[model samples]
Target: MDDFDDDSFNDVLGSMEMPTSPKKPKVQPSTIQPVPAATSTANSSNNTSASITVAKPASNPHSVLVHSKQRGNPILKSIQNVPLEFRDDIVPDYVVGRTSCILFLSLKYHNLNPDYICQRLKALGKMYELRVLLVQVDTPEPHNALKSLTRISLLADLTMMLAWNAEEAGKIIETYKQFEKRPPDLIMERVESNPHQKLVAALTNIKPVNKTDAVTLLQTFGNLGNVITASEERLSQVMGLGPRKAKRLFKTLQEPFLNK
Candidate 1:
């Protein structure tokens, strides 16, 4: 009986399913929350609007930038409004006094050499006040009348005549009479009293040759003494002399030697 019982138990155990451990509860992982598309777009729009507002100009009109380089100097700014004649009248008094010398050269009919006039005036002490006035003589005749007019004009501190017109003689006389109150020293007075002395006096009024030109001319002739002795022909070849000037120079050179 015991053996049968044992066998029956074994058969019963074999027939039954083996006991298994209980299954664990199913578990879920924690989920991350996703942002809303509308909220994200709204934040982006707000940032863009804020940037645009900041870029706008400030309220103050005076805040505008001014370029200093574009501005003009206040002192010189109004100069353009002044007239030329008025401005010229404002020349310094000292300059007028220094340049007060005048030269009146009459070129009515005959052609006068400006170079010769300059040289002659330089010989005179009044060269600084030398001025040239040119007059045209349309008619001939009435020679003595014109001569008288010329004589009167020559009475000025320093005056010279190259050509005279008969018709213009009256005009010259009228002009002289107008300035008669303060008549210039008569150059002719010296001319008549002592012709040779007058020639030297004329030289006193001459504008001196520039130092460089004088030195150069002197050097070319070997010395001032040599230059004085040199013939016009020789002088003509020395840089600044021309044919007309050569003749004048010839006259000048011969004058002193002849007088001596």
Candidate 2:
């Protein structure tokens, strides 16, 4: 019975089957393709078109650059390379259409060279839409600075007068090129004379009194009429003017009033 039982146990172990392990699924290679050269070029071209910007061309050949920032209303789009001769109130109709204007007077009253003036003008032109008009004045001849200034001021934005006589102007023109830098000694700029400037200029003509004294006198007295009516004692008390200058100034103002 022991032999039969041991044989039966061996048979039962042999008849039982072992469990099988599961197999993993295999990964496939990627099917996505590389981009074509033409597709890439097309995409780049689309991007370029989207980012690009266009600018408008100027109305005239003489017009200032399109990118320039305009300030005051300029009389002309751009300054002519050649200067215009100064006539009696000869403002052009074209000047009225511009954004801003500048009058360059190469006159007897101021001594700036044409090149220096042009350089400065161009700088203003580049920075703003400025048109420059240049004129040469004969100093020896009876040229009225005030009249010229008034006429030009009426037509343009600003006026610059070079305080040089015709002879000096000619000398500078002969020696210096229009594109060259200006010499420090040769540079003299005079703005359009207003009432105050005229007053100062007139007072500077007096003996022992200068520009500083004239300004001081004006500051002290307020106006020309006051300066003329001021007592010599009061005028003498000013910083620049002493007793002699005050007396002279008092006398000068009195003469004009007395004459009138």
Candidate 3:
């Protein structure tokens, strides 16, 4: 019986298949796609073409605008408003760099009005530039008048004086001619022999001093004649007098006598 049982078990074991192990899940291999090639040459060429277009300069707008405006406006329109004589006066006698001198004179008178002097100056202006100094002397005389002429002549490139008559003017011209050998100082001295003319000449040279001040100072001191005689101390007491001014007055006073 044992033999039969053992043989039956062995036959069953042999007939049954051995227990199989669990199978691993199958893994499929991954596929990689290929990358596209770079377009570097095409990109570089496009950038170079763009840079060239940006480098060129544009035309100037301001210059074009100015030309357009000038074409629209005519220069003659502005010139038409000026008078013919005035335009002629603006024109120069010579070329741009040339030089010339113009002079003017104003005669003083105690009895005569400024209107007469102004009228004379205006007439004289036809030839030269005339400036009026002043009018009216406390004491009018030929010497003072001549002095005035001489003084102005020294200061100006040219001189002109108001003459009571043509004969008086001729006499002055003759006198000046005689003293022409001497310089201005000697001429002034000779001219001062006439007190009235001396006063005129002194006043004309001492122009930095006002006419009103000259008249007032002379009046306060006495007159031009006596003012010349007064000491510096006496002249210094006047309202505007200072040391320098007092000295100038004293010198002017002595000029006539010294020149004589």
Candidate 4:
């Protein structure tokens, strides 16, 4: 029922492979940037001053903040265009946006110590709204590691990103930073108008078909799936469809979803 061909793909390799993730920096939370100034106003009636304080969010909109521990990481050198600043106070590897952060691990290292990611995830503990457990697959077979990471992602509410190599991994990080402020419509599925109209429009787009014929097929078959599964002979039975047109529609529907 699915189209996955796992045998066709292999894990990626690189000269920058590290056997273990960098150790967590020994820094205090107080190292974060100073708090934003508060507004103080005097209430003349009460003869008392009141102050309103709003906590400043830790994320930077312009540049991605990286942990100092990742100074030697090859991924950092691949990230282009976006500015990167190093810090030691943050827990995650790369702070890409306001609520997003990445924790990187390589399969080479995960294989050495299977439970390492689990301990890291436990310490991470739902800190960022968007926590990415980015894994670089450096081994020949990565399915077992991917499976474990996938399960961990589900349990820890962390998003999992699998990178074939360090260059691709760096590009992924760069993309997250560059598009962090862009609207989601760039990648979202574009919906045009209502469902019924959209379906009719789609069918009419095929060669030798029209709006009236499209609507007729829908009415006759009850739904899109049923219409697609209907036989060419049954389609010819419809009021407007001829043998040639019905055959075309049936053949088109049966075509492979992909060109290859």
Q: Model 3, 39: alpha-carbon shift in Å?
A: 64
| Of candidates 4 and 1, the better by TM-score | 4
Which residue runs does candidate 4 get wrong by more than 4 Å? 1-60, 192-201, 204-245, 248-260
lDDT tens per residue, model 2, 1-260:
00123353334333322112231211222322111111101111111111111122223423322111111212111334323222112111112212333333434322222122222222232211334343445455424543544343333334433423334423332222232334665566664369899889888988878999999989988998888878989999999789999888888767754543
- Badly placed stretches (over 4 Å) of model 1 are 1-213, 257-260
**CA lDDT of 104 in candidate 1?**
26
Candidate ranking under lDDT, highest first, comes to 4, 2, 3, 1
| Candidate 1 local lDDT, 1-260, one digit each (tens) | 00123353344334432212331211222232211111101111111111000011212311211112212212122223221111111111001111121222233211222122222222222222322222333335435434533433353333433324433432332333234344467433534365534343443332343344444565677545676788778867867655665566557656753543
Candidate achieving the largest TM-score: 4
Best by lDDT: 4
Candidate number that wins on TM-score, 3 or 4: 4
lDDT of 3 by residue, 95-206 (tens): 0111111111223331122122222222222222222222112234445444534443333323444434324433333333233345657535454576645555566566
Off by over 4 Å in 2: 1-191, 256-260
Candidate 3 versus truth, CA RMSD in Å, comes to 49.7
- Stronger candidate by lDDT (2 vs 3): 2
Q: Write the per-residue lDDT of candidate 4 for residues 166-257, one digit (tens) a residue.
A: 88888999988888888988999877799998999899988798999999989988899999888889988999889988999999999999
Candidate models: Cα lDDT each: 0.32, 0.40, 0.33, 0.66
* Reference-based TM-score, model 4: 0.58
TM-score of 1: 0.21
